[model samples]
Target: MKDIFSTIKIQVNEKIYVKDPETSALGRKIIQESILLMEEIGFDNFTFKKLGTKINSNESSIYRYFENKHKLLLYLSSWYWSWIEYKLFFATTNVDDSFEKLKKAITVVTEKIVDDKATAHINEAVLNKIIISEYTKTFHTKEVDEENKEGYFLIYKRVINRIVKLITEVNPEYPFAKSLASTIIEGSLHQHFLRDHLKTITNCDEHVSPTDFYINLIITVLKK
Candidate 1:
C-alpha cells in the first residue's frame, strides 16, 4: 500500500488553484511550508505574504499558484479528502462481512492520523491537524452554494457517501444512513477538536480516543 500510494498523485479540483502546486518545485514548496505555517499560526492569521516569506519567495509567486488563501484552503481540503478516500477504499475494499467492513471504514475516518512517509512534499499528520482546525473555513462562506454547484466539495461528499453505503449494507432498514455517515465524518472532526482544545467536555483523551468513541457509538446505533 505504501509503495502504491507513493506513486499515486492526489489530485485536487483545478478550479481551486491558478496552477497545480504539485507540478513544480516552487509550487510543492508552497504546499509543504503552507501546511507547517497554517498549523503553527492559523487560517485567519495565514496570508500569502507570510507563506512567501516562509518559502523565501515573492508574494506574487505564491499568487501564481493560488488566487488567494481561501482558494488554497479549498485546495488543501480537497487534497485531504481525496487522500482519505483512498485510505477508505483500501481499508474496506476486500472485507467480506458487512458489519466488519462498516467498522473498518469507521476506523479509517475516525482514527488519529500519523504521517505517511510515501508523500514527501505533503505531511499527512500536519495536514490532518490543518483539516481539524481550518477545514470549516473552506466552506463556511457566503460563496459556498456557488462553489458547491461548481463541484468544489465533490470529493468530500463522496467520502461521506462511501460510508453511507457501508451503513446501509450493515442495516438496510436504517433510514438515516446519510445522516449517520455525514455525522461520523463531521462529528469525528468535532470530537478531535474538543479532545485537543476543550478537554473538559469531550470524553476522548490519551486513553479514550475518538476512534473508540465512534466505533462504540456505531455498534450501539447499528446493532439494533
Candidate 2:
C-alpha cells in the first residue's frame, strides 16, 4: 500500500483538469459553494440542483467535479479533517514542554469542534445520529477499501495517536494514558454536540468552552 502522506501529496499535486482552465475553476467553485450550502441546509437537504442554482450553474456542470452527493460529502469530510490536522500540527509544534504540548493539542482539537462556521448548518441531534449510523455502517455494510481507509486514518486517527504518545511521554505513570487520551479527544467531540444540555447539566450558566474545559481537565487528570 502507498504511504498515506505520499498518497495525499500525490492527490493534491495531480491536476484535476488538463485542458480548460475555465472548467477547472468552475469545478472548484462548485465544490466550494456546495460546501457552504451543506453548512446551511445540511447534507440530507442539500442537493446538486440546489447547489448549482445557488452558484448560478446547471446541475449537469456539478458532475464535472463530483460524481454524486456521496463523493461530494466524502470530499467535504476529508477537508474538515485536513483542516483540523493542519491546525493541530501548527499549534503543537512550538511547545517544548510535554505537558504544555499536550494541553495545546487538546485545545486545538476542542476549538475546531466548537468552531461556529463548521457547526452551523447541521442540527446537532440529527447530525450526531447520522454520523454514528454511517460510521458504524461503514465498517460492516461496506468493504473497507484500504486506500480510502489509509487516507481517513492519516487525516484523523494519527492526530489522536500523536496526542496519546505525548501523554505517555509526559508522565509514564499516567494511568491508562491511551484510554484517557481517547476520552479527552472523543469527549470533546461529544461535548460539542451536547453543548446546551451540558451547560445546564454542569450548572454553567454560560456556554462551556471546550478548549478551556479540555485543557483544565487534562491538567487535573495529569496532576492526580
Candidate 3:
C-alpha cells in the first residue's frame, strides 16, 4: 500500500499529534470535525465523544490520533503556526527591501485570513478564531513545561526566529529583536481578539486597520 503520510503536505512536527491526522480517513475526520465542534460549541464543552458522534466514529477512534482534547488543540495550534510561517516565507521571499519584507511579514500575521483550500481538512478561518480564543490554554497548562521540552512549540519558535532575523537585518544594533518578535506575534493575537470583542481596549484607532497598527508599530520601533 502507498504511504499516505508521506504525501501529506503540511510539515507539522510529529510531537504535536499522537498520529498524523492526515494519513487516514478517520484521522482526517477527527481533525476536520474537531475544528467545527470546538469553534461552535467552545472547547470547554468539546470532547472526544462529542467529536466522534459528529464524525460518526467512536471516541477511541479519535484517540488513535490525539491523546486528549488539549493535545488536539496543540495539534491545531501547531498546524496554524506552521501555516503562518509558510505564508510569511512566500510573502516576503521576493521582496528585496528589508523594510518592505518586514512590513509584508507583519501583514501576514495581523491581517484577516482568507480561506485557504490547500489544507482542506482544517478550515484556516475558523481555526484562527479558535486560536484567538483557545491557543493560550495549550501553553498555560501544568504540562506546558513538559510539552515545551518535547519541541511542541517548534513552529511558533520558527516563526518568531524568522521575524527576529528580519529585524536584525534592518537594525543590527537592536538589543531586543527576539523580545520584539514575540511581542509582535503574541500581542498581535491578543490585539486581534480585543479588536473584535472589546474594541475600546485595543491600541488601534478606529480610522486605522489592525494590520496598519501592527505594521506601523514595528516600523516605528525598528526603522531607526
Top of the candidates by lDDT:
1
User: lDDT, candidate 1, residue 206?
Assistant: 93
Regions of model 3 farther than 4 Å from truth: 1-8, 203-207
The better-scoring model by lDDT among 1 and 2 is 1
Clashes of 2: 0
Tens-place lDDT digits, model 1, residues 49-141: 999898889999999999999999999899999999999999988899999999999999999999999999889999999999889898899
Candidate 1 TM-score to native: 0.99
Count of backbone clashes, every candidate in sequence: 0, 0, 0
Residue-wise C-alpha lDDT for candidate 3, range 110-187, written one tens digit per residue: 777766766667788999999888988989989889889999988889999999999888899999999988988888
Where does candidate 2 have its weakest 10-residue lDDT segment? 9-18
lDDT of each: 0.93, 0.58, 0.84
- On lDDT, the stronger of 2 and 3 is 3
The candidate, 1 or 3, that scores higher on TM-score is 1
> lDDT score of model 1?
0.93
In model 2, which runs have C-alpha deviations exceeding 4 angstroms? 1-23, 112-150, 196-207
Candidate 3: what lDDT? 0.84
Candidate 2 residue-wise lDDT, 1-224, digit = tens:
11333224212211222222123567557655665676567666879899989989899877766666665655444444555566677678878988888877887766633332333332333433333223323233253465345453355466677788888878888778878877776676666546644455542234557667877777787864
Model 2 Cα shift for residue 1 (angstroms): 34
